[model samples]
Target chain A: MLISSAQGAVRAADTLITANWLDYLLIAIYFAFVLGIGFMARRQVSDSIDFFLSGRSLPAWVTGLAFISANLGAVEIMGMSATGAQMGLPTVHYFWVGAIPAMLFLGVVMMPFYYGSKVRSVPEFMLRRFGPGAHLVNSLSFALAQLLIAGVNLYLLASIVHALLGWPMWTALIVAAVIVLSYITLGGLSAAIYNEVLQFFVIVASLLPLTLIGLHRVGGYGGLKDKITAAAANNDKITPAKDQLESWPGLPLSGFDSPLLSVIGIVFGLGFVLSFGYWTTNFVEVQRAMASNSISAARKTPIIGAFPKMFVPFIVILPGMVAAVLVNEIVQLKASGGEAAIPGGASGDVKYNDALLLLMRDVLPNGLLGLAIAGLLAAFMAGMAANISAFNTVFSYDLWQTYVQKDKPDHYYLGIGRLATFAATVVAIFTATIAGKFGNIMDYLQTLFGFFNAPLFATFILGMFWKRMTATAGWMGLVAGTLSAIAVWSAGEFGKAFELSGQGLAFVAASTAFVVDIVVSVVVSLMTAPKPEGSLKGLVYSETPKEDLIDPHEASLPFFQRTVPLALIALAMVLVLNVIF
Target chain B: MSHTPERYDAEDARDDVREDVADAGTDTGSGRHTAGAFDIRNIIGALLSIYGLILTLASFVGDQSLDKTGGVRANLWTGLALLAAGLAFMAWAKAKPIVVPDHIPHDDDRPAGH
Candidate 1:
């Protein structure tokens, strides 16, 4: 075998992740401690509120960390690493442009309605503002979406744990589900939040070492970029021109090797529409903000989250960049030996999804390796817990309680909430089983995210700010918006089924839905009778007074005490990274 | 729209425990802050302590490896680190006990059980 002159040669046999007693001890301790937390949290389950919102007593810091950690799923760790390796610095767009601005908007603009309006779920806001029809549509879709997400998390966890533990895939999944569900059922949202905080810390601890070690081995950040450029030059297939490697965030929609979606897609679709829709309206993120006890705490949740979020591309995407370079070096070494000068040359095929796994096997030692693997395992569980916890609440409150039974005792709902956790877990297990049949699970999940969140932001914006918007108009716009997204996504799936180079026009459809929802909402609103501002207190901009929305505590503190300063800092960091890279 | 306390959960307030923390900010810490709200720090410490003790003990008995683990007994190191964290959490919780004001005002109409 040709030894490539990069950092060091990685033999095939060395990739095996063998766990000694120390490693097993760490893993065992992790599981036991997790189960213990579940048991401990059990006593605190006083009512349905405690079961769902952790009694809404979490301070800003807890909710804030949980908010982002809830999202740092298997997808973000694995898929985003693949993105970083494939796209280079531009994948940072996902954190910077796609998430941060929208997160800020959610904190500053939407918290009044979400937190102050006394809504239990996102759909509750729909019910209060737009009435039953819209509530039914939003809540049902959200519930289903969450279940599918839980399954995706399950599949990712099972697959990775299967690799690390060398256990049957089913065994790993069942153990994870049992562990996560136990705590969730016992402690409820509080359990999920508490665990999410743990997962957040663990993920950071696990990934930080990998980045530092990899950077040290490959030389520092300066050398890292230079190595990538040199590799790109040698492997001409990465891009047509060396100019592509000149700066960070190369050409948009340049495809494969190029980082970033097209400028139009990033600005119009992601930055303007999709980001706003998902961050502002998605119940998953909004739930964390809503759980804070005080108004200021709730509003500050996402803002605090945004700070850590800015650094995530470094944690997630940088490793991918390193992996991509390593893959190229291996491929280049093989090609020099007169093999097929083709796409699948030298190393057969390097699975980008396995980039972090490769990095782990290459760099991390067995004990820390096991801990790192555990951290990864925790990430998936945190994601799974977030989904199942959210799903159970929405399912119980929105569907089961609303449509099936009504006005039972508080204890009755609390029991149902616990029961709902099991139900959600079962559905997720089944969903993960089915998801195994899919060709690419990531694409399937992305389609679901885009299908729901893309158009919903328009309805949310109008509903929150526009008093003249009728309840009928709100529901109608939402329905029309949802249908348009579906139509586009379905068409793409249809095209792909026939082997036509036509997989869904994600950005095109999302951007179009943003416009379509706005037009449909305005036209429908004018046609229907307007709801008066007086009847919309706490739910609409005009009636939800600015004073009620303002953080009373913020005034007593300095400007830096507020979230805006942190948001500004986050933005400044993004700008600096963009320039340097 | 006539207000009957908004019936917070339309399904059956009995099953009303879903969604993110947003519309669910009913915990003003007004109602009984005690029944096991050990600042969440307590649990973190407990967890760290449990893991630390187990791993620390295993470090002596477990198969030693320099080739596999970059010459570091990571379990032993990480375990000790976690132990300290757990103990610190216990100390912090003991040092300061927080009490919620009796009348925490908010516009969130507290549903039954909230």
Candidate 2:
């Protein structure tokens, strides 16, 4: 038995080790193609706004597509797929419940405020509403946030690339960084977004076909059903744990111990938090929306984006559950190489990360495998481009230009922007090593992300709606929010380390900060005098859309409001399947 | 007809010639074209696509039942749903033409005859 086990391991190692010059050639070809896109985009680069904002030239659809593509990096794909492998179907509740609608609302509601106000950066809004002091604080915090974020993205992409191809870890990291930096430096936002558009296609084409092929190999849907049903017969992890069937973080739930509560919590808590935060305030997301050619175009983009967002689980997550069904079949047969040899969480949950990768290796034919690798690279590239670009924009425009050089030439600032992009890439690499040390870095990464963003989201939101929110109030609220989230995270207060699939604690902290910032900023702004009239009016409101001064009517949004309900229906369908199986 | 910078074919032809000659030598303007590198339409389509794909993938994770006789029906249904949604989007954008704005207004204003 020992000899046989060793032989199996040896064969697997050999298969991985034998990635040849062909593979390297393929990788090089991909890099060359991506760099070619960058070189093509160079002629478009101009002054600051064009570099940072794509010169605000994007129409609604382009903004929406680029926005979604920017965030769908290798990290999110691997991270979310890993979650599905561990947690099951309810995991998607994050995108369906929280993120989709928030993005839609951002487009239809908040975008006009930003676009109409003509603010160059998210921080610029805070500065105009409050003062230069608020701008300084927001800008500094955002720059730090992007710096940390750049590191996390690099780590996620590197891990996947190293695991699949036997590329040295740093090789993957540097290659990934270089690909993104080349385009961003040359073409700026335009190049980044354009490449992101291409990456988006390659990724979906790769993942979708592989998912279908896996389903076929597993004896189609019925075979998948039989396998999952058999597993559920033996294991409880296939269903919600008794304790987890409880409550959402903020919204009411049936008391804990109710069998349905865990499912509901899974649907809302895990699903809502992850999706909402990404959609609402993340710069990569907002930058896409802000690039719309017109306010009306911006508003329509998210609604269009959301219509398709309702279907995430069917493609990315279900494949894992299907893999779960085949776990025993694959293990017993001990099929030659690839996913068939490993089972879920058998070695550790890290194998769960290997689930999708393993599936592609075992099932896909050679040419198709090349396509899959290309798709994975696309995911990595799209995300890397977004992160580096966001870091560059914030550093050059928000940090260096604002702080380091008060009055510089347009060309000089552009040069600084390029330099900042390179420096940010280096800093991100160092932080990635720190990221590797954490056992489950998702929650910590998220909470830290929230620490920077929670305060900022609150200040941005308040600055738009409320006239009186002073700069001091915005700054104080921001500081208060970050401090509160950190205090909550450090005390082991949320119970399990990976509670609610790793996002519940961070969500609670961020939501708390958002609320507190609003209450404090509003009260203080009222107590203090309003900003001196027209001085700040141009920063916050737009007159052409008469709806700007007041809260836009929350009338019956038959299509808009139903997104959550539609999500719930989809969730119900999944739950019904789990029950039957 | 309304005298809003109206130009007859002969006059417009002469004017075009004059403008071509007028703009021949300026380094800043020479050989420079305004066509942008990026197409917001494609980027937005791609972004919406990825998010849509994620959501679609999520919906399939839970348990569902299909006719035993209809082999691969469920997977097919799910794939069809995703492909339909994804492709429909790409197709719709292709059908609807994009209209680029003629110019972006600049914030800094210089004296009229610099």
Candidate 3:
């Protein structure tokens, strides 16, 4: 699968976009700044804390942008645009319904416990609240997950390099891996965070122009809508034009025959369980919030990110929708049931993944094309760096320091972290090959989230709220929850029992994992002996004082600067968007 | 607070005072040398400005390719916008620089328990 895809990518490379010296210059300049920032950040890393968590000294704005940009990987950008092309406006749910509320919850409710306790990583928090059993389970699983997901990002990154410069697959993989490895090992989390902020702007600068030009080509919003309606009339496989244009009760995107079941699945499975599981508990994003300077800044990081996140669909999804109408290849693919042979390329079929590339080739001129390519590079690096940094922190602080060398000096652990970063990047190159076997990367990603994050969120939320939850229950619930999600996924994949596939099956699996984990936790808690109340201070919600969870200084600040007000405003704005679309 | 003994260190108390002073300095619109050598805003501004400058130059000298984008000079417009954004970031950084205390407190001083 990997070899075939590489061959196909090589064949499609020349036809995608031809670049000149100017494009190469822009890319080279971007690389120079990326490395320069890494070198500058290295000077600040004096201790383990600085290497792992930026010393918890960064202001909220920097962490906030990093929080979002770390997530805007090449897979996310391309996958989302592909989703937009296939599902139309309904893709907005992944942002508004699935992401925003969870991010707000993380900011308003969860960050206090995380930041106030001063845990370097999420699994460390698990150790404090639960015990060694759950902490070990969480850390090992988290380390493995980050490596695999890092491979996904690395694979896509290498593919983009190959597509741009026509480099051999192995050569592209090694170069991309080395560049990310250099920055992360040099400056640690600070380097990753700073570059993520820069990448956020570059991503916006590149995608915004593509979106505007694509919209203009389709004759504005009305023209796009008319074209979509006409196309829907001809294509029987697609959802109706009305359903395609609207965001609510999305039947096609959810893969449910009944409207009621579709809405329920979206609301409970995706909106509540999967979204919260990924956003609130996933260490990649929580690591960003945990790096904020103060309690208030920590709480406001995700809220600040929410403001930009809600509007991202306008740039990302709108371009895909415009491409569906404007690009002939995409239209033909959609008409022929999503797989049609390309005219001259060795790639047999033009998938929805080609929508953004096709639109860029069709619309963007030379210089702007270079910027877009740079944006992609920035995104992929940001993603892989987030994974590697998070992995190193867990490996050094949570796993190594906790288990292997308990009394090692701080600098020893820091050295271990740097080594871990280098090792993880090399491992990701091998794992990237594993990622290439899958036809649709999104399904693979969602299933992995089901296995890792969903169960972990259940354990965290239950243990944090209910002090009676025991250490045995903590690990037990995680193990059982993860096993159940896997069982359900296997049944769906092999037995075809769920009558669902793609994201819907992943959703159902996650929801089952969450519910089963919660139930098992509650049952196990009643049977097992709990930790003493005195040890639970600052770990459990009921035992901790209110002051520890809130910044006292925030009382004097204006309403706009406060966490709750900003979160509420963001919530209201997203709701308005849902209604508008 | 048996759970966290490190929160009561004298170093933390001193750093708290420094943080307050630094926060006040930024609030009152006074420039302070906080992470001055490695301010992220400066780096971001510099990169954006260079990209913006190159794109702006390329718009005039490089291929216009009017036929591709339906007769729009995308490079020119995007270049100007990026240049403006880059300048704004630099100005914002100059006006309100982030204040980093010398010793930022790390509250996780408890021993790792197995």
Looking at model 2 chain A, report the run of 10 residues with the lowest lDDT sum. A246-255
Winning candidate number (DockQ): 3
For candidate 1 chain A, the 10 contiguous residues with the lowest summed lDDT are A5-14
Error of 1 at A500 (Å): 12
Best by lDDT: 3
Q: State interface RMSD in Å for all models.
A: 8.0, 13.7, 6.3
lDDT of 2 by residue, A490-553 (tens): 5445444433334555666666666676777777777777666667654554313356522242
Kindly list the per-residue Cα lDDT of model 3 for residues A1-581, writing each as its tens digit.
Answer: 99987775756566456888888888888999899989877876777877888877777888899999999995568778888888898888889988999999999999999989978889999999888999999999999999999999998888777666777668889999999999999988989999999999999999999999898888889989999999999778766889889988888778888889889988888899899999999999999988777889899999999999998999888988998889898888777767667662112357777688778888999999999999988999999999999999999989999999888778898899989999999999999999877766777888999899898889989888999999999999999999999999999999888788437998999998999999999999999999986999989999999989999989988999899999999999998998899
Descending-lDDT candidate ranking? 3, 1, 2
TM-score of each: 0.83, 0.74, 0.93
Total colliding residue pairs, candidate 3: 0
TM-score top scorer: 3
| Residue-level lDDT tens digits of model 1 in A195-229 | 88877776776687677666765667777777777
All DockQ scores: 0.13, 0.06, 0.30
The better candidate by TM-score, 1 or 2, is: 1
